[model samples]
Target: MQLPVEIPGLLNYWIVIVLMMVGFFVVISHGNLVKKIVGLNVFQVSVFVLYITMSKIDGGAAPILDDAIKNYSNPLPHVLILTAIVVGVATTALGLALIVRIRDAYGTIEDDEITNQERDDA
Candidate 1:
């Protein structure tokens, strides 16, 4: 029986999954706050790739309506992704701001060290 995610046709999906796993690993395993943010961005990029891949239709043209073009790729996904990109930028900025604050307060961005310091203080 043929699986839905065959290796030949779904290489992009496989790549995305691998990227997600790498990102997830970095986020979970790394103690540095900056590394976690980089991992999160990687994960976000993989999701964006998945969405774009899913929205693509074979032989589909841009969403311009024309008599000659039968298949038109859905623009909604692209639009939503654009909004997500904006939100992602804002979120990243906020995260950086928080990181700066955390660094100022704790003098370190490593999660383990910060927690250890907190424990010593408290």
Candidate 2:
């Protein structure tokens, strides 16, 4: 049950996964709120890229229910990804707004400093 070109496909998937993991790790490991936001954006964009890549066939055209084009792809994935992208934008916006609040409240944008400030205040 061996495939002739397993390495190529696996290599692509591996790169995608590695990029995703790296983005997430950067988001979590960053202490600056803005950096975290950038990381999250990277993470989200990576997922979007992966999704769009997966949605494409060897030579499939855009999915439109029209009589002119018969080799159309399934539009569900693209639609779902559009929704996900909207949600991700909203999430990123919320996170940035929270960062603004955090900056105003703590006078700093570093996560550790904010936590320390809160502790000192308490």
lDDT of 2 at 110: 91
- Error (Å) of candidate 1 at residue 48 is 0.9
Off by over 4 Å in 2: 1-12, 65-70
Clashing pairs in 2: none
Per-residue lDDT of model 1, residues 10-108, tens digit only: 888998999999998998999999899888888888888788888877666888778987887888888888888888788778888999999999999
**How many residue pairs clash in all the candidates, one count each?**
0, 0
Off by over 4 Å in 1: 1-8
lDDT of each: 0.86, 0.80
**Model 1 residue 109 lDDT?**
100
Q: Specify the highest-lDDT model's number.
A: 1
How much lDDT does candidate 2 score?
A: 0.80
